[model samples]
Target: MEPAANVLDLNQLRRSCSSCALYELCLPAGIGVDDLDRLDATVKDKRALDRGDMLYREGDPFEALYVVRSGALKTFVQNEAGDVQILGFHLPGEILGFDALATNLHVSQAEALERSSICELPYAKLQQVTSEVPALHRQLMRVISREVVEEHRHLVMMGRQQAQEQLASFLRSLADRYQRLHRDGSALNLPMSRYDIANYLGLVVETVSRLFSRMEEMGVLQVNRKSVRILRPELLAALCRSDAAPRRKDAG
Candidate 1:
């Protein structure tokens, strides 16, 4: 048998990138073991956070990218009037810190929505490694492009006037993201509060609450506080595409 020290090292290797639950989603497709090893070396320790913790504040210098290993975070910016506008809700395996790439300073603040763990990849070291691995460079571009696309999609989502449609689309989007993680699409646990959802959707908190109650009454979903179970996904899909105005009760 191998020495105890050697056996410990072997166990560490087994838990590296190749063995990560999100390896396929977070890393470049078809990347080899050697490349994976090199990339894994740049990752710092997993940082733990509790609810309401600030991962990074706006204007902080960006030194690394963060991947949500578990739980969730939300990024937001505040206006001069102190009104907060949530930029995005980030889930597991998704990368953050791209907002700083252009200016070298974070434009938004990132906060943990619940207990979470994040993998930090120092950008300078990451760049050096990616330069030696062409596939890694391409993957970086793909992640950046994805961030741009999501920003555009969010802008469009906020432009719609119907509260019901907006709420439905938001739920559907979360369900789709959950499905991507190989979880149940019909079940969702919202870490962000209803007020946060309202802010993100460009509606008032009262309207958001009313919309959820209406959807539950309509048999579209069952809401038990933060947990929601989608019952009529088809109806939600229709709400997203429909041009009809919301009922009088939802006019809050």
Candidate 2:
């Protein structure tokens, strides 16, 4: 196994990440050089989490907003049946814990699916900074808006799309997000396991595996365990846009 990383390494990474893909999307427009320095100073970087580690639990006191600097995170809520229904997967350059911003209490749990580094900006300091920095405020609002829009889209994906479409859309969405982080979007290193993907996609683990195999056979993707390569982006996009024919139960 690889040795675990340290907090110092995380801090160094953050400091050196001046050209990160999220810099433009995360920071407010027209932020002055001095303001950027202040914003950087307020962030507290944390070491990457091992697989299956809980970043925070539901009902935990909300203290800071977390930004995923690298790797993936899964947020989910438990149903009455004690099964976890995953809300979504957060990629690098995305912010987590927005639901807690207004209520000051977490409504769901965030867990690292792999070795994930994060930077925490304390709520108190963030509020103060936003008051002084108009750009920061604007950026925060944009982030919240993006979350709302994504949630709305997810609702449609779950309610209107068939199982195959849902699965295709999920893969395409993941690829897009990965690309945003300057990673190879077409080649996905899935941090979440088959069971987690199943829970998130509202399907069984076997069904998830079957879908992967079928997509591979159809030349839509190349799958090997947790890794996936999109062999035909256009076909996958077509399926995501509700154009692909539904696969038979046995076919997928």
Model 1 clashing residue pairs (backbone): none
In model 2, how large is the Cα lDDT of residue 198? 79
The most accurate candidate by lDDT is: 1
The runs of at least 3 residues in candidate 1 whose Cα sits more than 4 Å from the true structure, single-residue gaps closed, are 1-15, 244-252
Q: In candidate 1, how many Å is residue 240 off?
A: 0.6
> For model 2, how big is the CA root-mean-square deviation?
5.5
lDDT of 1 by residue, 140-217 (tens): 889889889889988888887677888898999999999989999999999999999999989999989988998898
- lDDT per residue (tens digit) for residues 87-139 in model 2: 98998778998878767899899999888888788888988888888878888
Task: Estimate every model's Cα lDDT from 0 to 1.
Answer: 0.88, 0.81
Among residues 3 or more apart in sequence or in different chains, the pairs in candidate 2 whose N, CA or C atoms overlap within 3 Å are none
Q: Pick by TM-score: which candidate is best?
A: 1
Weakest lDDT window of 10 consecutive positions for candidate 2: 2-11
Per-candidate RMSD vs. true structure? 2.8, 5.5
